[model samples]
Target: MKLRELALISSGINERRNPQGTIYYIGASDFVAPSLLNKLIKPSIMPSEKLEKHFLTKQDVIVLGKGHNGFVGHTIVDDSKPMVASSSFMVLRDFHVKVLPKYIAWYINLESTQQELRSYSRGTALPSINRTILGDLEIKIPPLKIQKQIIEIDELKKQESKLTTQLDQLKTIQLELLLKNKIKNYEQ
Candidate 1:
């Protein structure tokens, strides 16, 4: 099934910052690869009154619409606070009953799909992925049970990667400490 048939695809908001703004603005910088948000830095503030319509909801899929490095997609799992994506993103919402937002996000983040999206990008300096290209892209819709299974597996892989990184860091620290002790004993 084509993506457009599965969900509504629309461009994000284009607005300037307001110091006293109430809503959080999510830009390309706030997003990390493989469907993660970098929450270390606070998002920019944007006024809420005029931009209420652009507020993001839970399960909304956000896709990078403009960039030289190709597009990245992620699902909005949290909607406890008011937040909106910037102009560089395309928001996918109101999904069909057969589809899951995370499933679509996972599909979009696939390496092969990234390459395909890059091919559709226009312009030489800063390639951009527009709504039309995104809408026409084909999507595979499996059973809901399978979709849930895929999402669960992806989460497990991510956890494994995180732990492996930590283990490597610990090993490096242990080796450094061992070397230091050996040098001290030799000197003594």
Candidate 2:
């Protein structure tokens, strides 16, 4: 099914104005973090009250509407705090029951999908991805139960990977300490 069928896709802040209220402004450059927007050093501002509607919420997805050189089609999910997205992104929310936000995010950022989206990118100065192009994408969304299962498994894998890395570091430290102790005894 097309992405539009699974979620409410809309452009973010497209107008130029100064900060009027307390809000976070996220631009294309802020998307330097891939996959998920965990650390956003986005500038804080006081925007118009109306712009509150564009504030990102949990499970919201953001797609870079412009820029290339591995920037276009950059998709990230906002499972974090609410923040305003810049005009450079297409914000997707109100996901259908069948779709998982992270799943869609990961799928969009896939090298193959990014390749296709990049192909549609236009402009000589800066390549971009149009909303229509993104909406027309047919993505396979599994049942909710399956979606949950997939996400859960993926989470476990990530945790395992992290733990493995930490363990490796600890092992290295242990070896270093063992060698140091042996050298001290030999010196004694």
Candidate 3:
């Protein structure tokens, strides 16, 4: 089924230079997976009226629009609250129950899917996927139970990746210490 049938694809807030009433803003680069908004980027205030429609929730998926082809399909699962995406992102929300948000996010971030997105993108300098392009994309929905299992497995893989990185850092530090001690011994 088309992505629009599963979720609403909408443009994000167009930030105003100046306006009345304050609302939080989130640009495409402000988020990192597994990290909440507070640490990645600070929220800036825009006019509430300007932001009324772009408010996001934990379920929202924010995809980068205008960027290098490598980043065109880059996306973030919006686990953060009380914020809105800037014009650089296409916000997806109000997902249908037949699909899990994480599952769809995983599918779209897949290398194959990203390649397809790049093909559909437009621009001479900074390629971007507009709502129409995003809306037409298709997704296969598995049983909800299967989707849950997939999500669990995906989370485990992400955890394992993080642990592996930590272990590599420790190994590097250990090697550095051993080399430093050996050099000192040689000098002595």
Best by lDDT: 1
Clash pairs for candidate 2: 20-46, 21-46, 21-47, 22-46
Kindly list the per-residue Cα lDDT of model 1 for residues 2-52, writing each as its tens digit: 999999998998878776766788888886655567766454675657678
- In terms of TM-score, how similar is model 1 to the real structure? 0.92
How much is 166 displaced in model 3, in angstroms?
Answer: 0.7
| Local accuracy of candidate 3 as per-residue lDDT tens digits, 107-182 | 7877888888889889878788889888888887889999889878978998999899999999999999999999
lDDT, candidate 2, 26-132, per-residue tens: 77666544544447364466667787788787677888877755434333444354577788889888989878887887678768888888787788798877788
Error of 3 at 168 (Å): 0.4
lDDT of 3: 0.73
Q: Over all chains combined, what TM-score does candidate 3 have?
A: 0.87
- Separate clash counts for every candidate: 0, 4, 0
Best TM-score among the predictions, by candidate number: 1
Could you arrange the candidates by lDDT from highest to lowest?
A: 1, 2, 3
Model 1: runs farther than 4 Å from truth? none
lDDT of prediction 1? 0.88
Question: What lDDT does each candidate get?
Answer: 0.88, 0.74, 0.73
